[model samples]
Target: MSEAQDDDVQEFAASLTRMKERTDRSYGQLARRLNMNTSTLHRYCAGDAVPLDFAPVERFAALCGATPQERLELHRLWILAVAARQRSRTAAAEATGTAGTPPEPAGEPVQDPVSPEPAGEPALDPVSPEPPHRPWFRRRRFLVSAAVATALLATLGSLSALPDDDRRPGASDSVEAADPPRATRPGTPRPKSTKSPSPSPKTSSSPSAGASKKSSPKPGERTEEPSKGPGQQRPPAGVPLTWSADSHVWQAGCGHDYVIARSPRQVPPPPAPQDAETWAGTQNAVHGRQTLVEVSVQGRTSTAVVLEALRVRVVGRSAPGRGSSYAMDNGCGGALTPRYFDVDLDKDRPIARPADGNDSGVTIPAMRLPYRVSAEDPEVLLIDARTKGCDCSWYLELDWSSQGRTGTVRIDDHGRPFRTTGIDGLPRYSYDTSARKWVPYS
Candidate 1:
């Protein structure tokens, strides 16, 4: 009916298309909401045909929280949109009227049956019995819009605070959904989506928003920004250590296959081969002196395998980081391995084919580490990870030929082997000193 009304209708139509794309609603779901045949609904949103009595369909647009002005324009488009296609017919009417000397050709536009005058209150005696009015709040759709707007603000703020480095993992990440794995160009900063702290329901209208988790900051410790580098291990030839884990997807263990070639992120080739005896095989020679270790993740039951080759056996004691106390028992299963197997190391106990008991158990405390392994090698390479809040010596050693490059797994104080921190040349133990942190001579 007016220039402003036309603009509103065009905008309303555009908004509808966007909403359809954002959620997972099926075509049938949308069709039910639009109250039209699914096929026809698709055509209308594409700007194909203008409908008649759009008031019914226009109400559905309310979900978008469009303004009252938008609704009015939508209604106008329903009635007058086809006018553009009927220009020739209008011209014919005017010509006939002029020839007959009709009352007034100018008033013809106002009396068109398709579109009527402004106010849209209907031209049937404007003064006769006014209709009941709708309260302002009743017409306003506030809840849905406010929720959407609030989540947007929080997401923006979260993205703004991420770090610049790569190769670090936090347990806050969700392993299942992995919220965000591939690092996007830093358009904004946010924590690892995988690091969504144990879910807490954050649905409130007041100051408290989002879920809450226990605090783990050291006395004056601050929450460090996260990095998005690939592989939990660090790259070679950097400072003390440089590591990044894709949180849930971080490559953890003694070694990985050639599939790393498929990663969109750039990575270095595998380590070169070296002394077969020193780098390839370790002796699993422990007898009558083994401890039963089993590993279970989350709340799931554990299926423990007595680390058949007790290669790196500890002869002495060790602490958080520094040490000559740590030792490797080197029991190579009569052969090398990265090969997954199930066996009982105890000969007297008769190795069960599919045994029923816990042997070597591993529970990765709370970490979003994607890579962790059970190996006894002294020199571990945790490629491309940044160290913070952890106290462990890092060693980067060259190795090859161990079960076709099975590599090595770094052991933590718990006697569990975790993935490399991506720090080349890092050791197994660490100690914080006033001047510096040092390692034992190899």
Candidate 2:
């Protein structure tokens, strides 16, 4: 194999290996579940062979509990590996001059040749003689022509018997006008058709009419601006931006606290940051006092997108939940320099503001908005929303514009808003790493 081909295969194998390691499954275990030979599975993960079909790879990813994004990345790598393998095979075939060449037969077949007749006389059947035949259409030519002429004459006779007004121009329009109009609902108005009317026969035969018909928009074609009433603002047809919000971020200095309705003894030990979402779900936990979310935004096209501002919308507020608060980490030691924004949920009208972070005595500068992102350049924003008086449910609105088009994208925890409640004076507990148990903290 060429060096490039080898590299592509190895890269795909490395991704598979990482996925396997994350699942903590052995080769024999995975092979049994996948219904494949252990050695064959090993070869695939070792970059010794590539699967001809993607079905097994997809199943393998599902078995390893891979996320949607991870599965997409894996499929992309698999495509590259398959392409490289095909190229290598083609190169080998061409080098041996066997490409597109048909294989030769092993043996030749024998056949008998017929004898030629005498120079002037044609061969005759020995037993009997047969009569000559005529084609079916040729024998019925007169009948067929007569039938066509009779049909044409009958059509002309029928037309001549019609009334003169029925044959006049715009006769069809008069017939339509005699019918009653369609009835609409009492309070509802009929919607006007967006499509243009069909041209009349007189104008339809003109060059300009044909050109206009060709230029008209087809059915279901999206318009840049949809019809709307006055004083109303509508977003452009489509925005070329994509974003995802992860609410399972770890907040430093806050000690990674979460509020749950369960007791300290019922809750398990603190999970790693990556598994925080799963852990929270198992415990039915919500962020305590504050929640830190990580938002990733990227443009789907090559055009740059300007992120104007981040606004917070308060969905609702209620009394804080009466629950026990637990801290995932006893102490977090690291410099916080990420682009961060702070939202105070206790306010009547909350907004995202640039915030600075401090580690020990070093202060980190705050990052502001009006950032630019494209297909090649993506941006991540960290939002830290805190509440002290009530349990607040809120989501973020991101204003963006690209190529004179502007729109807003909502950032939330999946389809629901992020919830943060007051944890002051609540029963607090912390996980002790050495003891491997939850310990009450003041």
Q: What TM-score goes with each of the models?
A: 0.20, 0.50
Model 2: per-residue Cα lDDT over 1-442, one tens digit each: 7998889999999999888755424565587799987667778888989999999899999988789999999999999999999999998988886865433334321121132222453433334432234222232455567779999999999999997544444432211111233233222222211111111212244445534532212222211212235654532335456666677677653367899988877888887665677677767888998898877677766678888878888877998899999998776765544447988899999989998766446665676789787654456678989998899988777777766555555666645678999998799999887988889984
lDDT tens string, model 1, 1-442?
3455445445545655665543223334467676766546555566554455565456556644457876676566555554543454466677677545335334334223343333433343335532335222221234446668999999999878876465454422332333443323222232321111122111234434323442322211112211224553322211111112121111122221111112212222222221111111121111111121112111111211122121122222222222112112111121111111122222222221322222134221221122222111011112222222222222112111111111112222122222211222323222223423423313
Clashes of each: 77, 0
Candidate 2 overall Cα lDDT vs. reference? Answer: 0.69
Model 2, residue 27: distance off in Å is 35
Query: Which residues of candidate 2, in runs, are more than 4 Å off?
Result: 1-236, 357-365
Global lDDT scores for all candidate models: 0.30, 0.69
Local error of candidate 2 at residue 121 (angstroms): 44
